[model samples]
Each structure stands twice: as structure tokens, then as C-alpha cells.
Target: MRRVRTTHLVLALRGLGRRRVRDAALSVLAPVVACCAALAGLTAWAGAGRAGSPTRVRVTEGRVLLPSVGVPETAAFFRIANEGGSADTLVRITARDVPGDVTLSQHRMERGDMAYRSEIDSVSVAAGERLAMSPVGVDLTVPVPSKAWRSGDLVPFTLEFRRSGPVRVLAVVVRPGTVSPQ
Candidate 1:
């Protein structure tokens, strides 16, 4: 009876040893395979030819000119930089915080008359260059209430990029004759 018991114990020990070896091998192999798969996926994502695959944008500066009744429109400026290998565009501009409509406008000299025209299409930003859009002696304009904002006030504005989408920026309110360095 004692010999039978010892033989059964030895068989159980061998089974346990085999299981530990199998588990160790699987633990190492599984992570290695998973890592290889992850690397392959990342490589493929970067290889796709897309404009602004890795683009960056920020509000360089913002200012607002005082508005008067019937001239409730103000102008704001932005500086966009595209670090990607491809070019991008300013798709749209919106003021989610302000209580008015915002659109892209440019000053045009039409038939010897200086006028502002709305730009509905996206404004392109060339690769490796900075695009500056401003209001003074320029085209970009923002319409707002005449007495809505004061100097040194911060208004939330969003700049929509063609490839980078929308980025929110705080625009500082200034007097009508304020100018920021380029």
C-alpha cells in the first residue's frame, strides 16, 4: 500500500513540473508576439500619405477693435504654423463663447472702392510657412456687439484647420487702434 501511494505522488509532481514549463514559455512568447504586432500597426499608421499627419497650430496673437452701433463687427487675427511635410488650410473660424456670428473676411479693392468680402472657402497655409491673418489693413474680420467686450477682456475663439480641425484660443480685447507685432 505504501509503494502504491509513493508512485502516485511522483506522477503528480511530474505533471506539475510540465505545466510550469509550458506556462513560462507561453508568458514570454505572448508578450513578444504582441509587441511585434503593435510595432507593425504603428508603422503602418505613419506610412499613410496624409496632409498634416502630424501638424501643430496655436494662437500667436489676438486683438479686437472697438465697435460702434451699425458697425458691430470687429476683427481678430491669428498666426498658423504647419510643421508637417504637407500644407494645410484654415477651414473655418467660430466664436462659441461670443453671442454673435463670426466669419472670414478679406479687404478687397473692387472697382476703385475699398470693401470687405466674405471668404467662404478654406484658406490654405503652405508647408513650412507661417500664415498670418489680421484685421488692420487686412481682411479677417469678426462681427460682435458694439458694447459687448472691453479692453483686456478674454474672448474664447476657435480656429478650424483643414487637417488639424478646431483649436480654441483666448483672444484679448483691445481698443480699435491696437496692433500686435507680427
Candidate 2:
């Protein structure tokens, strides 16, 4: 009787195994495929982010000229490096110490003479591009504060962008007629 029972159990297991090999393979493969798909989706989501965002835009070689005598404002220059994957635009800049909004200006040549003109619009920065702001290029005109400002001082300014929002950077005050300060 015990041998008969053992034989019956072996037959039952053999019949189950032979029923459908495809079904068994699919049961194991379905979970693996689902897990692989989920991992792929997570990887793509992690890699997807707006390029040239505020977090990725770095201000380098930045400086602001000391307010010169009889000069109502001074220009702030910097090398804005966009290290991200998307383009961005600088919309506004401000300093509480200054009276009003900082103006974005660019130098344009007309008949071999370069003149200053207010941008009146945002300046675009391409992804992975370096925007060099200098005395002869695009720059920010910061108004003189009520207090006397001199060289070697630091001025705080908040730069706002269309996509990256606001970023605060300290600009060192350099002497007048200086273009790049370190």
C-alpha cells in the first residue's frame, strides 16, 4: 500500500510538469519583464531634467566696478557658464542696496562706434555655453547705492531667470576701467 501511494505521487508530479511548459516559462518571465521595465522607466526619469537650470548655471570671473565719481551706475560682469542640457534666459536682476532694478545692457557697434543699449528683454544662454559679460559685451548696470561704495567691497545681487528662477551671487567690486577682475 505504501509503494502504491508513492507511485501515485510521482505520477501526479510528472503529469503536472508535462501539462504546459510554456505556461511555466511565462509565469517566470512575466515578473522579470515587469521588473526590467520598471527599472528602465526609473532610469529614464532620473536622467530627464531641464538643462541649464539655475542649479547648473555657475557664475565665474564675476565682478562689479566701484562706483566712480559722477558716474550714476556701474556695470557688473561675469562669465555665466550653463553646464546643463537645456537653454535658459536671464530675465531680471536686483539688489536691495540699490535703488531700482538692475538693467541689462549690451554694446552694439554702429559705423565703427560702439554704443550702449538697454536690452529691454531677457538674455538667452544656450546649454553648455559660456556667456562672457564684460565692458565691451553684454553686462548688468547696477545702480549706485545710497551709501558710498568703493573698491574691494562685495555687492550682493539676485539674478532671476525664466526657467531657473533666482540665484544669488556676490560680485566683488573692482576699480574703475577694469574689465575682468580675476
Candidate 3:
């Protein structure tokens, strides 16, 4: 009877030891598994929308000039750069702050020093080139809102492209004849 009791005690001790070892191993592996899961999530997020193509179009230096005294319209300018291997066309410009549709217009000087403004459909930017819009050249004609505009207001504008999709930018509002705050 004493021998039987000793054998049972030894077996119970061995089972407890095995359970402790397994618990230690699981505790050490928990953090490693969590880290691996976090790394995989980050990798998947970074690879989204960049599988086979690169972002090659960049828009910068955006500014909007406030309308002068009695003028009912204003102009916005931007510097668009295309760093890709092919050319891209700027298809549309939209502003949430303004109520009316923003239109692309060109300003040209005629024979008598008079300025002519005409609405254009689209503008193209060549590869490895930049298109700078100024008051004397290509610009976006924005209708003046009913509310009074301050000098240092910020306006959001979205520029859509043929191949590069949509690029969003914030344009600074400046009084007419004031230098841009780019």
C-alpha cells in the first residue's frame, strides 16, 4: 500500500511540471505573435493603391486672388508638375467653398496691350515639366461668393487629372495685386 501511494505522488508531480513548462512557453510566444500580426497589417496598408503604378503628378504653389472692388469674379493659380514618363492633362477643378463651377481660363495680351480672357476645356502638362499659372497666363476663374472674403483665408481646391486621378490642395486667399502666400 505505501509503494502505491508513492507512485501516485510522483506521477502528480510530473504532470504539474509539464503544465508549468507549457505555460511559460505560451507566455513568451504571445508578444511575438502580436508583433507579427501588427507588422503584417502595416505592410498591407502601405501596399494599398500602389501595386503596379507610382504617383508621378504633384501640384503645388496654389493661390487665390480676391476680387477687386466691383468685380464679381476672381482667379486662382497653381503650379503643376508631372514627374512621370508620359504627359497628363488637367481635366477639372472643383472648390467646395465656392458655389459655382470653377472654370479654366486663359489670359492673353492682344495688339493694343488689352488682355483677353477665354475659357478652355483642359490643359496638358508634359512629362518632366511644370505648368505655372499666373494672372497673365492660364488661371481658374472662380465666382465670388456672397460672403466677404478676408485676406488670409484658406480655400480648398481639388484638381483632377486624366491619368493621375484627383489631387487636392489648399490655396491661400490674397487681395488683388498682393503677392501670393505660397
Candidate 4:
């Protein structure tokens, strides 16, 4: 009877030991499994365009207006079109030939016919919409180069967007008072 009791005690202790080992292993593996799951989910989300509608932006009718006699800065205009399902913001503009930082500026009319121009940080382009930049509206204020810009000269510009990334476009140089082609 004593031997039988001892054998039962040993068996119970072995079972408890096995349970402890299994619990410890599960505790260690749980976090690893969770991390793997999270990584997979993130990868899938990125593959699907970062969990939202992709932004597709196209630039057209790009023109750079040369500075006139007394004007120190020139302006660049473009017809920006967003054809995707997401909205995007034009954050920055860069030119290879221009020396200084290109800035985004807007022209607004006040109470009367008085026009006001201000430097803007960014401009938003709604999804499936077109933003046509003109001299009297939103335009990029670019620093004028010392060398003169002739009409029909092509200037390379890179426009950075918040979501759509950088877009390279060549703008045709036009005279200050001349109308650019559409």
C-alpha cells in the first residue's frame, strides 16, 4: 500500500512538471507569434496602397513666366490634375536651374479690386479634380536666374506631393504678358 501511494505521488509531480513546461513555452511563443502576425498585416496593408486609395497626380500646361523689367522674381504655373481616389497636397517645388527655394504663392482679391499675394505653405488638390494655376491665382514663385530666359526654353521642375511623390515636368518659358498654350 505504501509503495502504491509513493508511485501515485511521483506520477502527479511528473504531470505537474509537464504542465509547467508547456505553460512556459506557450508564454514565450505567444509574443513571437503575435509579432509575426502584425508584420504580415502591415505588409498586406502596404501592398494595398497603405490602407487607403492611391493618389495619382498628373501635371499639364506647365509654363514659367519670365520676370519683367522691374520684377525680381518669376512665377511658374501648372494645371495639376488628380485622377485617383485620394486627395493630395503639393508640398514643394524644386528646379535644377533655379538657385533658391521655390515657394508656393496665392493671389487673392480683397474687399475691392485690390489684389493681394501671399506665400502659402501648401496647396491641396482634391481627388478627381483639377487645379489650374494662373497669374491671378495660385502659382509658384521661383527665384529668377541672372541669365535671361528666352521664350520656348524648357525648364525642368520637380514637384513634390504629400502622397503622390515627386513628379518631374518640363515647363516652357513664356514672356510676362504672353498667354501660354493650354
Q: Estimated TM-score per prediction?
A: 0.61, 0.66, 0.67, 0.68
Order of candidate numbers by lDDT, starting with the best: 4, 3, 2, 1
lDDT of 2 by residue, 1-182 (tens): 99999999999988888777767888899899999999888677567764223436887766888887877887889788878777789999888788877989887767857565666677888877889987777899888887888788888888887777888888888887778523
- List runs of model 3 lying over 4 Å from the truth: 1-55, 179-182
- Candidate 1 per-residue lDDT over residues 35-132, each given as its tens digit: 99998887775686443366666557766665655775667876677767677778777886556667776655567666556565667776667767
Model 3 lDDT tens row, 77-144: 99999987667899999999897999999988899899999999999998678988988888999988
| Residue 102 of model 2, lDDT score | 92
Task: Give the clash count for model 1.
Answer: 0
Which candidate model has the greater TM-score, 1 or 2? 2
Error of 3 at 2 (Å): 99
Q: Give one digit per residue, the lDDT tens place, for model 4 in 56-170.
A: 9999888899778756788999999998878999999999998788899999888979998899999999988999998888999999887788899999999999999999999
Query: In model 2, which regions exceed 4 Å deviation?
Result: 1-55, 180-182
Runs in model 4 with CA error above 4 Å? 1-51, 180-182
For candidate 4, the per-residue lDDT at 158 reads: 95
- TM-score of the candidate numbered 1? 0.61
Best by lDDT: 4
Please give the lDDT score for candidate 4: 0.89
Please report the candidate that would top TM-score against the real structure.
Answer: 4
